[model samples]
Target: MDITGERASESLMEDTTTEGSTMVIKMECTDDQPQMRENQEEVEKLKALLAQKEQENDLLREKIQTCQAPYPLTPETINNSSVPNYFRYCTGFTYDEFNKLCRFLRLPDSETVTQTHIPLNCDKLDRHTRHMPLRQEFLLVLIRLRQNFDLEELAFKFQIDIQSVSTLFSLWIDFMYDRLGVSVWPHRDIITKNMPDDYKAEFPTSFAILDCTEIKIEKPSSLLVQCEIYSNYKSTNTLKSLIVCDPRGSIMFASALYTGSTSDQEIFRECKIKDLLKGLLQCGYLKRGDGLMVDKGFLIEKDAKELGLKLNIPPFAKSSLRMPVSDVEITKKIAKHRVHVGRAIAKVKQFKIVSGRIPNSMLVNINEIWFVVCMLSNFQQHIIQT
Candidate 1:
């Protein structure tokens, strides 16, 4: 009975040991299953992240390719093409004429002209981006003047942003005005040399023909400014300038722009023409017998007489309904002489910026633009036949 009881106890101990080992193995398998699921989830997340990075890289490569693509309208392409074609298209000048103008201005070759030639406050310009060459800047100004293209259009044509176009246009306009404005007003001797024989025979003592020209502008927002620039003649808001031209239709002097409401007489006085006349007298460019042929608008007869300068204005019939034949003949002669000044004004207005209503944004540089246009007109073929 004792042996049988001992055998049963040993069998029960073996069975309990086997059940404990099985539970321990099952727990280890369950823990490993959860760890395997977590590792799979982690691997899926890594793959998703890698795919997203590759997509971004593809998009970046596409952008780089687009940026690197050559544009046909780029400055380099234009320069590489026939200079005559671009010169006439870009600047209204023939190749020979353009090169002659450059030589006259003491500028280097067009390729060598760069932004460094002009002084500018370039703090706002991006240093990382490549800058447009100087000749391109010059061409930009001419294009703006010749074509009157706005900033956006110019930006597209030049393959640059609008801000760069604006900056370049403004800086180059001021630079050109500073460099070329002085040449607009030449000495009286040069004017005399170029005077046409018709002018000499008709008005032997006349030095210059004086006139006023009006340029239409966008109406200002302010009521006072609107009133100040409103013109009765143009029936629109305008800016006015006093212009004097030699008989050869070369602009000798151009006054700073005045409000269109101002009269020719007011412009004459305010522009200090009397002082200019005084200087001319002192320099012997004008003597006692020298005259400034003017239209009736000038009304400076009394003031001019005080300075010993004759005011050759056409006779106005204050009371008569009709003038005598002699007076009519005199009016015809005066009108004929005055045509040269009108032609000079027309040449300056060929730059469409001044020909059309100027935008208010451009008002700040209007005077400078006016000076540039007038000065550039002198470089063109003379208005009157020599």
Candidate 2:
């Protein structure tokens, strides 16, 4: 104990020595090591937190930009996997038929639908966004035509405004018309090859069954417009057009929409369907004996002979006590075939856009709308089986 006390006394007495100074320095470094480690750990945690917050903020900002657009392109439900399966009920086309329509129109895939675009007629819908796919827009237009949904209904369903709907309807109709408007009259040999026995037995060399259909329209406000569009026969304002279909009820040609008061013969003259027939005959689309059928109302018998095509119109009855048996049989036969053209037109009218009273808003683009409806009718089950 005496020796230990003597050593401690000596150690204190030498506190200013170099060895004691080194010992003090080592102790101080050990004390600071823990604090430095703790600070480094805290700095790493703070960096991780800041990185996480930055990612969240970036995502939030992107979504906000989408919401702030005037005409948001994001579809509410129609363009995504959540869309319903009742597409046919809404747009008058099944998925398969819609796909076929895309292929037929040469429209782009939904992934890159903006490849070929129609110029917007107005600035309201000019801000194209990724909200709605082009395929969905096509369906919207078809649904409007098929179901006759009001603008409000379309807007709520499509998440767009009424003006957008009107503009889209107008633009898409023209786009479809531009692609599908080409005449497709089949050749004589092609017709004969597909001729059903019913037609073969009656009229072997027939080309088309021609008729005129009138679609009622809203009464115009201007007296001059009213006078031009009022149909004396239908006793209403309407639009008329010539529709030509093959024996199988496939529409071959359609004229532009004319004033409802226009005569069938006038449309036939103006539509150039007669000229087309002449060209077809000259180009061997019709053989020497090939003829087209028409209702007796068309006064083109003289023109038919000049064009080197026969007319199988029903015979007219003279002012006699009763019709002859031959004329009656002929009328019966012609009437049976004529029913197809009427059925084709009726099927087109079933679309309701052209079937119901057409509003004046559609008057300017009525011709293209009419053609689109008529063309879509070909997608249905064939009206005449054979």
Candidate 3:
């Protein structure tokens, strides 16, 4: 009996020891699994953070490239090159027109706060010195008209600071874009008078012509913006502006500011040009059979069809080299009629503000300048017609 009892006790002790060992193993295994899961989660989080940083870095790199790129016309290059004279002729500004503009702008002999204690009606805004030499001010104005001046050359030729030239430019451009921007389409009464007699008698269905022009800008620091602003034609950084012209070729409409990167199709949508066109239509001015001529880039065929309006485009020539006889004939006739819009575009570009490459500035006030120029163009055209 004693021997049997001892054997059973020893078996019971062994079973307890086995249970203890199993509990320790299970606890260790559970703890290890949680640690492994935690490590994996940490690794995933680090990867996400890394990707985010890379994206930010890419954006920053693009920004840097846009800002640091060199402008085409340095002061030295402009003084030496024939480009300035070419610009003057293309822009249609004679010495007389230049002087007249100076007088109109109140540029020459406008009392500067620094020159005298004379407080004119004008108050200073940024506390930046508005006291520039009259020549410098004139040069700056000319820049707005001729946009191709060598800032460095102007500084050297006129003996003024380049920064002053740049500051005046930025300020004036802002003024032009914001304050002087004209409507995309004039009121019905205004356009009705100018409609061609034949068209008024017959179809009475003509409205406006639309086109886009590229303006160069200084390189941006951002690579993305740089890539965006770089146009194939200019082979430089540029912004695209959309202009709408009346039958007389006077700009009835101009768009708000857009980056150089914007495409014509995107700009049309972004600027809501359709809204302006609709306004003219709703006013009962533009009829179903009315027509507009546009370059291929406008991509407005669908809209024209829906509106029951005719669009005149020179048919794409079969051979890239020679235009079809029908296409040539139509193009020549259209060009003659569309001369007013061309002239208007030419006048707007005359304001040095629209002439050359502009800097990638966030605060360009182009709308006001656009309006003022339109008003001027209207005034000038009437004078010429008379």
Candidate 4:
């Protein structure tokens, strides 16, 4: 121990004799070593922190993509993974029928078929966001009677712009109506081909059951337009349509749409549903006592008699000298049997597509839409019965 102490004292003494001091050298070495180690450790920690933040940011971005707009999640629920499934896809109609109808209408298809430089703007959205073809989930909801939804619920379901839903509906109404309307009306050839065998035995002259229903319309901007559409029954602005149903309440014919201001008789005259009936009669496609049962509003006794078509009208008070009591009683029975028409109308409006006040943009398409709904009702009822 004594020798070691003597050596350390000599070494200290020798270093002290040099130009620079040993204590100064020792202090500089100690300061630089700790600082360099701390800086390296800090840089590694900063890189880890930056990587963690980057990962968190990527996670946040994905959540934002699926988040509901204008219905921000609370802080507690932001990271929760148990969101409800709401958005529905279109799969109601049979694939065969849907594709056939699309082809029939000449609508463009995104599947397996490409056209070069087609000059049409039929696609509702552009390619960047067009992961799926234009889908009407709202209409499918109605057609399928999906119970878990309402208009507001669907606004979040599809991640679609709300106003865009309304626009899409109007456009679809036009497309469907135009396609099905013509088919519903009985062509002379079709009427001959599908005539009931028993019609010749009982009522050989019966063509179709005619009735009217008022669909509510949004109040017009002008008072004149308001007065024109206002119906006395509902005491609201409504558009009236004439539906001519077959015996089972399937609408076989529909009048062209007219302003609510037009009287039922006037609409008949102007739009030529009556003229078409007369033409059918002239061609022997329709015969008289071919029982024409109409509501009291259309009390055209002479025309019915001249057309060789038997008119069944309800009993009016003695003061109104239009038709005999016998005719009224016969009409009453026909009306009773025809109440199914009202029931058919009720079934049709149950579809929310037609239940609401239709958009003004779709007014032109209403007639065709009416026919399509009727056909669907008939098709559904047939399916149910069979």
Q: Which candidate is the best by TM-score?
A: 2
Superposed Cα deviation of residue 178, candidate 4 (Å): 2.6
Candidate 2 residue-wise lDDT at 96: 76
TM-score of 3: 0.53
Q: Identify the candidate with maximal lDDT.
A: 2
List candidate 1 segments past 4 Å from native: 1-89, 110-113, 128-131
Indicate whether candidate 1 or candidate 3 has the larger TM-score. Answer: 1
Clashing pairs in 4: 177-368, 205-290, 206-290, 288-308, 288-309, 289-310
lDDT (tens digit, per residue) of candidate 4 on 19-71: 36766787899889989999999999999999999999987765554232222
Q: Backbone collision count in every prediction?
A: 0, 3, 46, 6
Distance (Å) between predicted and true CA of 266, model 4? 1.8
CA lDDT for candidate 1:
0.78
All models: lDDT? 0.78, 0.79, 0.60, 0.57
Model 3 segments more than 4 A misplaced? 1-179, 182-184, 187-192, 195-204, 257-262, 317-328, 361-376, 382-386
Model 4 scores a C-alpha lDDT of 0.57
**TM of each candidate vs. truth:** 0.76, 0.76, 0.53, 0.58
Choose 1 or 4, whichever is better by TM-score.
1
Candidate 1's error at 67, in angstroms? Answer: 19
Looking at model 4, which ten-residue stretch has the lowest summed lDDT?
A: 70-79
